[model samples]
Target chain A: MSGVWGHSGNIEPMFQSATAEAVEERLQRPRGWNRRNSLPYTLVFLIVAYLGVFILFPIAQQFLTSFSNNVVGVDKVTWVGLRNYERLFEDDDFWFAVQVTFTYMVFVVAGAVSLGLVAALLLNRKFRGRNLARSAIAVPWAFPEISAVLVFLWMCNPTFGVLNIFARLFPGIDANLNWLSDPNLAMPLVIALSIWKAFPFTFLVILAALQAIPREIYEAAEVDGANPLQALRHITIPEITPTLLLMAVLMSIFSFKQFTLIWLTTGGGPYGGITETLVLRIYQTAFRFFDLAYGATLGVSGFVIVLGLTLLFVYAQQRQDRARRR
Target chain B: MNRPGNGLLLPRSLSMGRRDFLKRTAAAGFAAALATPALAQNAKIKIPLVSWMWNEPGRGDAWRAILAKFHAEQSDVFIEEAGAPFNEFTNNMLIQSQSGKINGALFHTTPDLVVRLLRGGHLEPLQDIVDKLGIGDKLSAAHDHLRIDGKVHGLDIVTVKFGLLYNSAMFEKAGLGAPASVEEWVETSTALTKSPDQFGIYSPHLMSEPGDFWFILQQWAVMFDGVWAEGRKPQVNTAPVIEGLKLFKTMYDKAMPKGTDTATANQMYANGRIGQQLIVSAAVNIWSSSGPDIYPSLRSVVPPGPSGKAITRIHPICVNAHASDDEKAAAKLFVEWLYKPENYQELMERCLDVVPPYPEAIRQEYLDKQFWAEGYLAGKSITPLEIMGDYIFFNQEFGNVVMDKFSEVLVANRPVEDAMADAQQELEKASERLFEGFTL
Candidate 1:
């Protein structure tokens, strides 16, 4: 019997050895291969075919569509090579979208990660109802995005919102502060809502990493007269550097592609496309204006920007991993 | 014989029956998957309709019941509903148009969208539908907006007339009557306003999706006799337009709920805290549902301005040009069935926001059931058909320019002249680029 009790403590290593042997045997043989290993080969073929049809094909199609005069819903395609790109470069709206997108990404990434790290540190400490606190912290992340957005929109109402009601108590704050309509405050409020919705996953990840750290290392550091701040700087910082770097890359990617939060709240308005992110601009160009080719061009440009950032972060992470190993 | 990279060889002792069974199962699954769509294609004459009306509460069930009745009457025909949220339906139509494969045979959308679809040549000519019905003389003046080159392109089901919808209770409480001109309008709004709690007026002054700021602000623009376009050329940045922009800015500052969009404004108005607003005829039903006492006290007047005109829009139904012949025939049949006098007025009454496009629809029996009948028919001081003089379709080109520049002026507090000039230049550029070779 291969059950745990029957095989005793050494079963794991034995199972690993058997898996290695099976792989070696499979590699060494060549005759009747289709009949012998049909299942895995069929599974892999299915996966590749699925990805090629749904994922890679659309991406390639978009790249080709960007150069053509494919006016949406019309059965005509005129090849207009590089003119779409030229137009994209010249358009003032495109540049404004780029500037706003990067600004939004930076603020959201920093705010979400910092808040997440703080929450993680607090929850990691031993206390009563710690488990309950951990569960409660995840509620924001689990909340439906549309529901949260609607609630926030109501709360930010200039006339009768709870937020405006509270603001009246402060000495200098305008009682009827237009949080969403004011161009100055709209983006900040959008960013705060995004941070609230996204920080929980970061909190959970950081908490797991924190719990994995050796208690003995912290105890020794304390015995040597190291204070909490010193321990955090020398021990916690170095230990969690990899996770932090990873989270930064992921959060940056998420922020750059975010559409629903910003679109639902501001829709690039209160003024003329002031809050328009690249994704929102692409949607407007494609669906609203029906300039399909121009929208595709904008999409490709955004993809390149995000891909470049991702590669840079990955390279940095690799360098850090090498330094840690040394 | 096998190649090196082919990996493991099967033992000669392995059974062939198991392998055959698996192969047969996979083949059967693939065949079944391929057969489903083929079977659907040949089943019945399915006429699907893509519309946002199904998003309304009672309308969805009414639509389904109508379709069921049609199906029962015509056993060979199937009516498929492809209803979605407004934004999603618009997006779906765009994608379908790009792919040149429209899923629905018929579609229902606003006049603005009808113009866009017509410009793209995505709509089938509905002149035959009108000619056969012989209701050309009965058609309202608003149908002029749906005609292209003397050919009917779509059929109007319902329309919204823009006017001043006021809470009579508030007006009485403030010892004010409905305003007749621009100055009176402002004075009444200010008199009715009592800071922080009760706003005198509620309209979406911000650029909002699903509802453009222009829809509300255009009433003011038209009242001031500002022409948005003459032929294909932009006539913005005129003196009248500048005056209209200034009036809107003042209204925003003195009366409107700051930073509120249409949804918020609608909610506030429904709660009876708002005094008056530029609202559509359909909103009477919406407000009535929220406050029973408020409905009885509600009153409407053609909002006064220099020209004494306001903006009104009609939503229309159009057939997909790409639909198959059978589907098109079925769609026509369904529409004919839908507009039979008994069915048409009953459906219109269920949703009080929309008025039927036919003048005959306002027959005494229909008005008796309509909640806004007094404002719409009896007094008839609000002349929706003739008040605006001509029915001009608000196309995407004009909408984009108006919404953006107006937002900059109203929300950003930009100088009216500079902003209007910017809007004029943008409109000219768009016309030059978009309408360069097209027949307007």
Candidate 2:
């Protein structure tokens, strides 16, 4: 070929430059787009519109109503400017509701996350009928809340409930135990039910995180003379720490807003507002008493507190990320 | 086709006449279309009537039948029964009234709730309707319970008398007679109770359900001649009130099922485990229908309180303030028909235990029923229409306050005196808040 066209090699540079010019000319021209290009923009607009109509508008209206006086059997609303908040602070029932809510949140979050972690660890290992066991564990979460609550109410009945019958079999335990009506036992029972309902989500999330860790790392640790405990501590724990933090935040939010199970079971209780949380208080204030303004104030206060905790969680996550990067 | 310049076209004068005829026809057709709806409306009047009685299975069906009859008789007027369960209907009505959009032309509620609604201007003054229908002469003296400041705002469709209801089988099994006084009630309850298997008495004692709890406590107070309020001010810490509360606590501890609500307790009663209940007469109708096996064993008598007084209520109904004038007229006509002797007898017969205040409606044959013996009928003479004076005007919120504190004593073992004192304070605060500008 070189002998056939000795001058072809000398023209190669010119050929390459001409091809480069053709590509540059194409790149310089504007792109022609069809309707397909607008898909992402349309999706974003739809999402924003849905959030605005369903979520943001109601929240903003609630916030505004919190500052006004909307009494029962009256239509006129007068701007009172934090008077409802002032009154809420002075109200004894409000404080009791706060105490109940915080206590419930702490117990539920700790119990759910700890139990979920234990469940995740068990499910991650190979066992006989392992899939069946995992499915069985999710049964409570899948059961409808109201239906489960009714079953629980029956089980906790003093006379005919199965729980009392079981408790009686143990020595020194009273057969006529009023499980739901007893002030001392009501909150604990509520917390248990909430954990039973919520822990499955945490379990599933943690299990996914656990399975994603490289098995080779554990095998390598084993070859280097590290035991199972040491490997779990140094590798597994650190890798899944972010998932645990996020689950805790999620469970806290869910427990704080719990209404149906608690409302249906004891209706905040056998008396003395023993099990009434902030959300139950808000419902009672708005629907039962028809004091929408005060209820809105309570809702707003709960929202602010939850927001602050979420921000704290975010800060902790950022610090962990920075430490890992370093 | 004919052109304007064609010789075959119509003359200008003849074309103008034809255009005028077409215009008149079009105008007439438009006017007829517009007037058709008005003509149909004038022919028939439909009034929406919402009833809390819809929650009562037997009574709801009975009332529907009566409304159907009225619809048949008055061909021009119709009653549309908007059905909702009692609790939901009450809440929805209150909300609708407050929102200035009452859904129905007429509503049936308890006397106390009616008073509060009247004060809130949710009910129209029925004085005109009452006078026009001659209802004042036809109605029993119990109708006075519906008046506020000399204006009749409601009419009583039915009245309930509260009394001691005992299972005759249980009484026979325990070898105890009916309780004739508060002490006897305690003794009878204690004698009949055997934990887990059977219990002595049943009452709705959950403070969270304040309305029912307050009604029960009001009955207790009335029996002891104890007053919780004098006009607008609260008198919760008085000796009689405290004594009555102490009695309640003792009954809860010793005889009644602890922490059991009325529904649970009624289940116990229906199963023949409960000895007695201080229930309204109408409850017998429900118990009989649900548990027919226990019907023969049930007997009722006026609750023998220490004061020789009893608590009863006149179930009153009112026209909604938001009702149109035509709707109001139809509603008044319906009420008038309901109070007529022949129609009233039919209503009384349909609702087994509920007694119409009208003498002609109270038949001797109904009194002979196992559940409605002479003992239960005796209360019609002395049962008081008004309860605890201005307690009716205290609204449901005041009851909530009292019940909240009332719960502490029953659940937490707080002293009756302390709980009553706390209740007094809370009631005063509530009264100051709820009844600010009006006289109780």
Candidate 3:
């Protein structure tokens, strides 16, 4: 029957196209939309207005005020043309800040993702107390940022901290490190804390992607005489590739905006601790210094930097996808 | 003890509007109120303070203590103080303002960006009320920071300042007396830094504007020979200033710790590696209170620069221009009461690190135990007015740039003079732009 009168197939492209056209027409029909159904549009309008007034407007106000020529201590603002930007350019601290923040973002994002992937792979397999362990792993994420930081701080306290106690007990660690005070150690410690706090998020996402992998593919690989280590190499990585790409893009943004842990734990100590990220600097500039113009300029640069990195990631993925599709 | 008691008092009658509860009076006549009036009055004043809950005495304790006392003074009106955390104070204040739950707020200093509140017309002006109460002159005569635009808006019940604290042992070792002139100070600094164990000076060369940079720079600029205009515009290129920078550079090159930088000072100091710190006199108590290992053998002195005239920065308690009328009135009373010698003493005792904001408030305890009194008194003035003959306005924004730029130019190997000139230009622009036309 020539596959039920199909053009070399049972499925008819014409019918599918015709049905899609009918639905499109029905959707676009002016009279078909119930005039009484105004709730959806009203909801949309309200959401936009709410965001504009509360969130968007404040952001715009900050951008505008950053350009202000108002005197310090007096709240009166006037637009100053690029003076803030010019000042920021010459400011030595600004350049150093740029270097510190960019470095933190690079290291944290790369390090966290790498470690997260490894942790995800470990947890992906079945083991005794795997369920309990999976739940236990998320405990760090459950603690509030400040509370977790407080505990971490107590652990890191130079004089009588638990970590120091351990160091002393072991007699292996030479001298107790002042985790909060030493500039050399502070940023890396913050990065460590951030990674600890953040990896759980990546783990959850990766686990989901790992679980969604078809069991049969692995069975097929095994049937083809693929070894456990070899099958895992080919089967696991390709399956969760999309999720890994999306997470890299998303977490890169998160690391760029990672301020609170640093703000609370260190408050950008050690005279602008190795800890002040772009977000911290922007916050201090905009809120503390009240240099909205310079703040905006820094913010814009931060935005460009973050967006460029994210786009590069996305573009790379898109190109890879296209190459595979081709 | 850190947790507050769960308690509330009802006035004698609920038959009236909630707003009218202020009129309800206790049965005790004025004479009867005198004996145990505090307890009864505390049971009555319906005012409550929203504050932060912390272990060490933060700014909230000062406010809480004042409110607790106010409750005793006004038996008919009770003041209840509740606290959250400092991190959430602003957000909580915003929410409270929205719900109109705030009777008044307790703050150490007026918030910087109060324009939003002023725009909302949340603050009540105290001019007319001050005139009626006849407390205006009494308050400002003691605390000048209360006036905004010649009108009263905020008040400081307590204040503090950074005073140069030195290691007298180091001074003795160097066989150098405190320098009264720029030349003497530079020479002293150069000699003191011959080794790693000691430093001639240890001050933040860079800081956020409106920070300690102004204090450090004030000590330097005046002695080194720099000046600013009526607008607080700094003239850094002057010969004295150049001489000062040259000395500072020489100190940087020959004397000061080779590895000194913004990011390393705390560690360096904690390691018992620095000799001088221009700490707030308040830190004298903290230093004494701290564990001996972390604490350095400390003494206090002002920068004996070339001018021999010592100048430092002040953390003045200013009034928020947006406080409501009743708030303004209550706040005025608060400020006045705080300045009363007894109340001032109580405040200093509670704040621990802080001394009374005014020189008039200084007493035997401050003189004997207080670092500023023990150390930095160079022809003491009773109030800040005495210091004003040698004053430079602290610009928070400009100070921020100075600190930032200073560290960059020096630690990061940028040219010192170029960094200074660039810093001044940036800060001046910031001062111009951030503070366009303040008549003050």
Best by lDDT: 2
- Model 1 residue B311 distance off true place after TM-score fit, in angstroms: 2.8
- The per-residue C-alpha lDDT of model 3 at residue B368 equals 74
DockQ of model 1, rounded to 2 decimals: 0.27
- Measured against the true chain A, the candidates' chain A TM-scores are 0.88, 0.88, 0.83
Q: Taking the tens digit of each residue's C-alpha lDDT, what string does model 3 give over A136-204?
A: 888777878978876786677553466766767775677665556566777888889988888888888
User: Model 1: what TM-score?
Assistant: 0.84
lDDT (C-alpha, whole model) for all candidates: 0.75, 0.77, 0.58
Q: Report the Cα lDDT for candidate 2.
A: 0.77
Error (Å) of candidate 3 at residue B433 is 4.3
- Angstrom error of the Cα, residue B59, model 1: value is 3.1
Single out the weakest 10-residue window by summed lDDT for candidate 1 chain A: A1-10
In terms of lDDT, the poorest run of 10 residues in model 2 chain B is B380-389
lDDT of 2 at B101: 69
